[model samples]
Structures are given as C-alpha cells and as structure tokens.
Target chain A: MRGYTSDKDGYLTRLRRIEGQIRGPQRMVENDEYCIDVLTQIAAATKALQSVSLGLMDEHLKHCVAEAIAVGGDTADAKVREASEAIARLVRS
Target chain B: MRGYTSDKDGYLTRLRRIEGQIRGPQRMVENDEYCIDVLTQIAAATKALQSVSLGLMDEHLKHCVAEAIAVGGDTADAKVREASEAIARLVRS
Candidate 1:
C-alpha cells in the first residue's frame, strides 16, 4: 500500500475539487471574464494543489520513507534519494 | 473583451488538458501506484497550471494594465495594485 492509502478518499475529494476549479476558469475565459478575476481563481486552485502535494509529501515521509529506513539497506538509500528528488520537483514546480 | 481574448482557444485547450492531467492521478491512486509516480504527475499538473498563470499575467500586463496605464488615471493605479496582488498570490502558491 502507498503512504496515502489511509487518506485516499480525502485526497481524491480534494483532487476532484481542484479539477472543478480548473474547469471554472475555462468558463470564465469563454465568457470573457476579467483577467484579474480569472487569475485569482487560478491562484486559488494552484494553492490548493500545493496543499495537496504537501500533504502527500508528509505522508510519504512518515510512512513509506520511515518503513524503508527501518530496513536499513540499499532499498532504504534508494527510497531516500527518490523522495528527495520528488521534493525537489515539487519545490521547483 | 479580456486580455486573453485572442488566445481564448489556446487557454481553453491548455485548461482542458490540465483537467485531464489532474484526473489521471486519481486513477493512479486508485490503482495503488507508487508514491513517487503519483507525486511526479501532480508536480507536472502544478507546473502546467503555473505556466498558464504566467501566460495570463503577461497578457494582462500587455493589454489590460497597459491600456489602463496609457489612459493615465486612478484606474491605472488600481490595475497595477491588483496585478501586484495577483502576482504575490501566485508566487506564494
């Protein structure tokens, strides 16, 4: 099981909400809504996505990484490296 | 008409593609995909959203904000302040 297994439903709900947030802007653009207003909505959605990423990162560190470290082997080293890379991508994105 | 009027179709297309990107991860989660893989997809979608915001911001500055500044009045000040706030939010997010 993945690190987020326990909170699977919560993550899915947030993701679905974000999908709606993204779609709303398309409608606003279609109707020629004010640029600032559309930007505001997009910012909100972006923040929401950021929040979700933080949550997933936390869970991954707490569970998956923790478990791998407990084993103390090449797998542990690889997992740590992989998690660091993912964090870097999230930060850069 | 909004600043993005000329690129409405392009923006819509990108937004629709982002919606799909967001949805793909839900399925990945449901299938118990690896944590890093899911996080990678989320980062990609987040980056795509950020790109769209940057594009909209550029258009807003070049068109709406430019026109308001060219008119030289209180409206220009308001637009500049508003755009600054939007930029701050995007940066924070």
Candidate 2:
C-alpha cells in the first residue's frame, strides 16, 4: 500500500491470470460438470476478486488519501470525502 | 457504471462469495489434490477477481470521476489527476 504503483506489475500479473480463471468455469459448465464442481470454481473466482478489491482499497487509503490529507484544507476534505464515499460504495457493493 | 452506488449491494454480494472462494483452494491444497486440479481452481479465482476490478474501474470512471469533473476548477483537476494515476496504477497492477 505504500507505493501502489510499485506493485502494479504484480497486481496486473495476478489479474491477467484471473482473466484465464474466469474462462475455466465457463468451459466446465458448458461441459455439464456436476453442480458442486462448478460451484467450487465459482467460489474460488469470487475469493480472488475480493483480494484485489482489498488491495486496491488499501492503496487508496494508504497512498491517495494520506497524501491528500497532508496537503490539508479543501483538497484534503475532498479526498477524505471521496475516500469515505468510495469505501461506502465498496462496502455496499 | 452509471450509478455505482446503485450496484453496490450486488458488488458486495459477489465479493462476499469470493471470500468463500478463496478458502476453497486452501482446502484443496491441504487435501493434496492433483496439481492440475488445484491450478484450475486457482485460475477460476483469478478470473473472478479481474471481473471485480473491471467493475470497480468502470464505477470509478462513470460515477466518481464524473462527479468530481462536473464540479470544475482545482477540485476537478485534482479528481482527474487522481483518477488518471489510479488507472495507471491499476493497469500496471
């Protein structure tokens, strides 16, 4: 979270792999795999997605929001509000 | 993407399910499953995470950034820069 950009390559690498992962379940379902088997794959995908979300949130909080606050005043307020709204959106999502 | 807040619940629901998904692979690994089988599950998880990332980015673009720009001036400039940096970070990730 310190330098969100620093780990960009890693995150993208993981995301690219996940793009492949999404396709796996589809092929399984198309092949008429067992319900439980399909569900398990779906579950796995969902979990991986959550990790990305959490990571992104941390980056936003630790870097973006923190920087904005350092500047202080309206920009800081805006950044804080923006982060709160985003967090709310993420939580609700 | 039109109204990020509107779909917040849906996003969260998917994410919550993903949390469960993450655990599935762990159990599989612990069970000493075949390498291929474990990989497939991992693939599925990665795909799901990507979908969420895309959705979040879309929401940020269509809703959050849009609102900040509408306000205009320094806040608008700040929001736009923040978003561009975020997109850059995300792409790298």
TM-scores for chain A over all candidates: 0.98, 0.86
lDDT of 2 by residue, B1-93 (tens): 233356655655665565556556455545544323333454455555556656666766677677878887898797677667655544443
Per-residue lDDT value at A77 in model 2: 94
C-alpha RMSD of each candidate structure in angstroms: 0.7, 19.2
lDDT of 1 by residue, A1-93 (tens): 899999999999999999999999999999999988998999899889889889999999999999999998999999999999999999999
- Candidate 2: stretches off by over 4 Å: A1-3, B1-93
Top-scoring candidate (TM-score):
1
- Residue A55, model 2: Cα distance from true site in angstroms: 0.7
CA deviation > 4 Å runs, candidate 1: none
lDDT of 2 by residue, A1-93 (tens): 232456665655655555555566555545544323333454455565556656666776777777878888899898777667655544443
